[model samples]
Target chain A: MRRQNLALVMTTVAAHGPLSRAAIAGRTGLTRAAVSSLVEELNTAGLLTELGSLPSGRAGRPGRALALSERGPAGLGLEVGVGHLGACVVDLRGEVRGWLRVAADNRNRPADEVLAELATVSRRAVTEAEGTGLRPVAAVLAVPGLVGEAPGTVATAPNLGWRDVAASGLCAQGLPLEVENEANLGALAELWHGTGTSDFIHVSAAEGIGAALVVGGRLFRGARGFAGELGHVPLCPDGPVCACGARGCLEQYAGEEAVLRQAGLAAGEDAVRRLASRAREGDRCALAALERAGEALGTALAGAVNLVDPEAVVLGGAYAELGDWLLPGMRRELTARALRRWPPKALLVSGLGRRGPLLGAGMAAIRRIIEDPAELTVSRSRR
Target chain B: MRRQNLALVMTTVAAHGPLSRAAIAGRTGLTRAAVSSLVEELNTAGLLTELGSLPSGRAGRPGRALALSERGPAGLGLEVGVGHLGACVVDLRGEVRGWLRVAADNRNRPADEVLAELATVSRRAVTEAEGTGLRPVAAVLAVPGLVGEAPGTVATAPNLGWRDVAASGLCAQGLPLEVENEANLGALAELWHGTGTSDFIHVSAAEGIGAALVVGGRLFRGARGFAGELGHVPLCPDGPVCACGARGCLEQYAGEEAVLRQAGLAAGEDAVRRLASRAREGDRCALAALERAGEALGTALAGAVNLVDPEAVVLGGAYAELGDWLLPGMRRELTARALRRWPPKALLVSGLGRRGPLLGAGMAAIRRIIEDPAELTVSRSRR
Candidate 1:
């Protein structure tokens, strides 16, 4: 609870401004003493630095300035996808200090092998980040699959052929770690660093479709942390048998693999890239597949928009690449079906792009330190 | 800010119970001085009563037995439906002190006429509640329509033939009031008064299907308070044209009118009651209609469950009467569609029955008292 309030104060500052102590008190509704005490604690933890003076309140007195420090309690992010692996570190100010990404076919690989490779890349990123004076306090691993309830175990990543993959085995030193679905992480990235709406839906795609809900500044993880599986939401219950055995799931139409296969290309990044190029070049078959995929995704997304009424729907991951081809159909369906409301703006492309999940992973990794100044204090003491 | 903390303290006491001042300090993380101050304030407001003593922790000293008082602030609830009008008053302890219900065909009636009749009934209930020594501090009116962002205004009620009607104009005397959709009130009732889990979807149907989401012990109002219009969520993009001009909205198949038409009966409460009675008696046509409605409802609910992943899906309103016939198909679809995990319990029936929304309305009316005891103090002063 202490950390929650402190974290709120820090995040408010990070999101809003380097406010004066009085402004912090007003914004956070903390008594001046409480704000001063928390600010002092944060300063001691190297999470904040006091700047000289800024324009003050109505009294016109000079007020002390404060800001997130650049080189303390950094967050580490790692992501595993079918065709790539990524690692990054971000400072308290949310600036990327170090980053690494690699292309690799991870599908059909043994879970242990892929995890080991991810760990090796993660350590290398850590070493690089440390050189720039950033310290990783925690880690969040993003996977293109279902991350289970248990800390770092992935229940399944169908595209990666993974099951019960305890990824934290790589960082067995009890480094606070969590495995999260990539789409959720992507949404988190958008919430933390992109367009500043607290209530919105983030849609991302890879081999399968994924959507994440950000309501009231927090990810809307459902009763089982399985809240946002937009891919499986039935658009046409009796249309076609899906991999989940339910018929007419949204994934059958818009997933990257589905789109590629429909476009008469093999499954993989190469196929996706070629499909994009062909569509851009006005090839008939490729354009048709993308167009149809857009319609299906749009129709399903319209239903989602109608139900949740988020401020906007952000396209991320591979879907970000196909926005131009998808937005027209997506907009048409949403305009017709989204409850005739002015709000929940028309579809918006994710500003964070494909690197969203990796960036979001880093943000998650450092959340504890930001939320609990005490955690940062302890981290500082240990260092 | 002051009242919010006061409300939190009062709610904490109301929820947990009779803790020592030191214990309150520990539980709320407020200083002992702050807790003592808040306790004194609540005691002055007639909201808290200290009874003798209870055994304490640590030092084993006797602690005052604190509890919510019965005769302090009360909530009055009123509801307007196509075929019914209901009102009730609940004390601080959430016990119903007085109630009144009437059956009427309110369709196409002027909003002013319906609201005036509702006010007359509300006054009667208020008089009855006063006779029982309960003062109505606030009221919540439940309408079968969309509650607009403005206080006590219904933006639309297609069934009631009302639009942009500000019903609060009737209660201009300023006993704090709000207008809410009946389905939303039902879900809140289930959360506050029934066997409780914070994350569940409460589905109820009248002329149209409505679903309300309860997450973390609070209603999820979405970006614009329109989060729970499940009736319009497209289940089949091409199945049938719906009143909203969308195709295959859940309402087209599972709404009361839809089911009655399918069951070869006139559309009304009598027909619904007869359909239930006949289905119970193994009447073939009635049974078949229920089966098809359940499947259609199930398919759409499956999509909702897949999107929200709530702990349970509760049936209320008229659906409670039809649950016996609808559960099988609903459960089957949910089981097949939900993530392959241990979550989202099978379909549940509302124990609160048709009265859930009214009860919930009462609770909402009094939420201010529970949330901010300062308001109670202010009310008492004005009196």
Candidate 2:
């Protein structure tokens, strides 16, 4: 019972905090005395701090405000993308304290080698956070593949030539670790930081297209954790075959490689950037290729919308960089094909871009501490 | 608190009865005395009955078993199909007491005229149920289109030429009425009475194809209650124009009319039955047409499965009658196109066939009384 009350207080403050004890009690339906007791424990653990007093509304002495502490246990986030590696730290306030990114060709490389490099990057990020008085408590790593139900196991990352690899124990050595799918993390980021809708589809792209569904404020993983494989939804039943042995999947038209190939550009680390620039400069081939890709994306999304009926569709990852060129064709197809009256405001471009997965990883770790502060508090008392 | 306990006892008995009072207390985490009190009230209200005593394993006397009363208030179900109108009464134990079906060409007919005829049928069903010692308390009408968020207004039924029609007040006089979409009700019936999987997709077809998603035992109504218009999902994006003004929708290839046309048969009330008999007799044209329709249905379902990842797909309504002819092409396309490994057991045919919608409607109304017997008890006490 105490643990549940503690969580209620902590989450209330995290969501609508910098509040007085009376305000916290009012919002959470707890008595003022109970709020004060929880606040004291949180303050002692460095999970909360007192701020300036609020002006009295009731002609009495003013009450001091309380907020989530900035110097508390923080989260360390790491990412293993196909083309890059990243690490960062986020505080309870959902603010990044340190960030690092490095270009690397991780595809098909030995898993140990890539994780070893990530550990080094994570150590640097932890040290950077420590310099600011933030204690790094836990870590989460996001990867572009299917994650097993068991924590820290990557069932299959086809692009990385990995199958059934254990990932958590090798990185962020001292902290407890969890692994998550990059697309799921990206959708969580959109829910917690971007559009803030409890129900939406987050579509992202890098080496291949991926999507994650958010339903009622939680990720909607299917029965086997294989929902949201939007990339493989057939666009044409008899068109050219795909690597997954499907014919004319949406990925064959809208994935990063597909767009570049259609634009007659060589595949490289900077190819998407070049294509974006070319389209911006009124190059006919680049413009046409992006428009067609957008149409194909819309066609697939129309099917998704007809089936799932999410409140919004967010364009994230590489797609965010090409939103202006993509939205027109997408809107046209959705308007014409979607069974529901397509709302113009339902399509949104993610502001987090390539940073969403790493940031979401950090936020996810921090969220655990906020939800169950008793774990940290119990350990602290033991120490 | 008393009302809640009463409902808990009723639903517990409905699900796992005929159980003893000791068993109810064990399953509900309530004291035996509390269970006895709730059961007394339920029995007094004619909502539960004491059955034969269970065989005792202990040294003490055996306890009488409890079950939902068959003589209590019942539900009236009504359906407005393009080619038929139906009415039935179901008792608290989910047994149908009375049923009536009449062929009616309701297409583009005046709403009042069709509803007036339906009221006559519902009256007969209610009278028949009452003769069997059951009182019909509520009714639910199932329609083949979008129902508004408001209780009884239908937003649209394109085939019925209905838009913004207030339906609840028009039919089943003197009984409280509710409105629901036929596809949604079919999925609910599958959950409560058929496959019983908490997560699956129910696909039904008549004039047009419809699909409903069940997530965690509840209907996943999208942002606008328009989530399952599978007929409009593009099958061949550029093949043929549809009445919905979209090109190559699934309806153009797999709907009842479409299959009849492909088989060189005339469109009429008995068209689907004729097609089925022909396919059974090894007629090439009917067999070929059914195969093609199955492929189109599979193509659309593969996209749905890729996006939602349901545990199973149930073929319902008219499609269930033709399952033997449809399963082959469906399995082939799903194996070829769906990203996840396809399991043959995931495809099922509804044994309820065309009766799912009406049964589901009656079950829904009965569920409301089962969930909250307080309303009935309180009214009875007043009398």
Candidate 3:
């Protein structure tokens, strides 16, 4: 119970910036004495630092404000896309300290080679922050496929050409690690920090459309921990064949590959972003491609509303930059096709976008540490 | 707390035949003393009656079995369809005591007139049970549309042509009454009394594909209480127009009207049953119509799996009797189109079938009484 309270206190502080002892007490509904005791213990553990004293409001002495200290530990977040891996070093308080990105297709590279490259980049990031006295407390990797119900293995990653890979084991060589789907992690980031805090669907529309469901402030991974495979549901009986050995999938029609192929782009994130920008600038070819993508997305989103009936739909990943041009058509389908009584609300572009996976990975590590404090020591390692 | 225990004990006894006190204790995880005390209190309340001595397992004194008293107050369940309403008087243990059906269209009849007809039928059913001295303790109405988030109003009933109609109030009339969607009630009945419980989508293939989402032993009504509006979602954008002003809804393609129009059957439950019988007898036209309906249903189910991803999809309502002819095509679509990593299991025909809504209404009343014991009262009026 005490540990639960401690976790809650730290999370509350993390959520709402710096706070005085009285403020924390009032917000958490904890007694002032209990708050003081917990805060004192946290300060002793190097998890919290006291800021300058606040001005006296009444005739008594001024109180000191407390905030998360950089001395506690830091988090390492990794996001593995189809052809790129991004990493970031964030403080225990969720503030990004350092970042790095490498472009390498996992499909062509061996798993061991990818891991070694990740290790090299991660080592560089650690060396870059050596003088700050910050330690990499935990690492979280966000991959792009359905992870199995059991934690260690990745069931399938069509884009990466990987199946049932021991992801956690590879990442957990000596450091504590957490692995999650990029879309699910994006959803977690949005649920805790973006518009759809209560319920929403976060779709990463890259090579394929990956989706995550956040219901009632919690990620709802269905039976077998493999829910939200939205891209694979058949939209057309005789439509084009999908890479998953299925035809007429939402991804086959609306994914980045489809958009790029249709627009004659290089099928890269930068190219996709450039197309969206050109479309925004009223380029005829780009406009037509984006409009077609939006229609397909609308049909898929209409299907989403039919099932989950969430409060809002969030679009991220490479194609989200298309923005309102994509949303209007989607909304039209939802209004025209969804249940009239409760059509889903407007779509919102993820503010975090590409950075969402990394931040979410950091959050996953923090959540792990808070949930099982015994793992905290395992996370603290000199790279 | 006492009422919860007593309700659990009574429900357990009702589900399984009359059980010994020790057996009840073993099943409920309640202490023997607490169970004994609850049993005593319930016996005093005349809800339970102590039967004669049970069979002695060994050479010890036989303990008396406790059973729900047949003389206890009864429950009233009503299923309000498009053009007809079915009423049933059931015992506290969910045993059907008497039944009645009324023919009237909510579209043509005034709201008050429909309510009056319902009241008249309810009064007659109550009188019919007078010989057994069973008086209704509560009533539940299962309407075929989206119910409101508010407790009393039916937000929209397209088939019934009622919007914001206070069906709950119409039945309450100074009595305990609860209103729910027919599909949701059907799912509940299947979950608790018919098929073994698991995640399933219970879709009523009626005038429209009214659906109920049952996950983790509870109905998941989405935000605004309109989760199962599957009928409104567009199956084909240009196939046919829906009465709800939407284009190519699943209803237009596979609903009762679609079946009736295709099979040239009268618009009634009997006609639906006759069509099912014809399909079973291998009538080419009937079989063809049902197959078409199944294909549309399969499309919707595939979409549903892509989104919510339940363990199984359960079919119920007016067209449930189509049986295997309607199932194979749907399964084919689901297997061929659903996410390969996490495809749902095969479809299951609801065991309750057409009678599910009736039983579900009773279950709703029972649920209400159990959730809020203060609502349960011993009426002074005789049956």
Best by lDDT: 2
For each candidate, give its TM-score against the true structure: 0.89, 0.95, 0.88
What is the C-alpha lDDT profile of model 3 across B1-383, one tens digit per residue? 66567678777777674888888998999988998987786676556788898995868878789887776666788877776778887776667888887766665556667877887777788788877877676788888777776776678777777788876655545666777888888889888787785788888865777788888888987655667777765676566778867677778878888877887677765778788778777888888888888887887777777777787888887656776678877777777767743334457888778888878887677566544333342223122
Predicted candidate 3 versus true structure: per-residue lDDT over A1-383, tens digit per residue: 66777776787777674888888888999999998987876776567789898664666877787887775567777877877877777776666777887877776557667767777777777666555777776788888876655565677777877777766654536677767888888888777667745777888775788788888888887655667878876666567888867677778777888877787778664777778777778888777777877877777777677666888788876556777677777777777766644344557888887778777887777666544433442223222
Model 1 Cα shift for residue B48 (angstroms): 5.3
Q: Least accurate stretch of 10 residues (summed lDDT) in model 1 chain B?
A: B337-346
Best candidate (score: TM-score)? 2
Q: By TM-score, how accurate is candidate 2? A: 0.95
Write down the lDDT of every candidate, Cα atoms only. Answer: 0.83, 0.87, 0.74
- Model 3, docking class: medium
**Model 1 lDDT tens row, A139-212:** 88999888777888999888888888888786638567888999999999999888888888899988889889
Runs of candidate 3 with Cα error greater than 4 angstroms are A1-45, A48-69, A129-131, A341-345, A377-383, B1-70, B102-107, B168-173, B341-345, B377-383
Q: RMSD of model 2, in Å?
A: 2.4
Better model by DockQ: candidate 2 vs candidate 3: 2
Cα lDDT tens digits for candidate 2, B131-229: 999988778898988887778778889889998888776554556788999988888888888976888889998788878999889888886677888
- TM for candidate 1 is 0.89
Best-to-worst TM-score order: 2, 1, 3
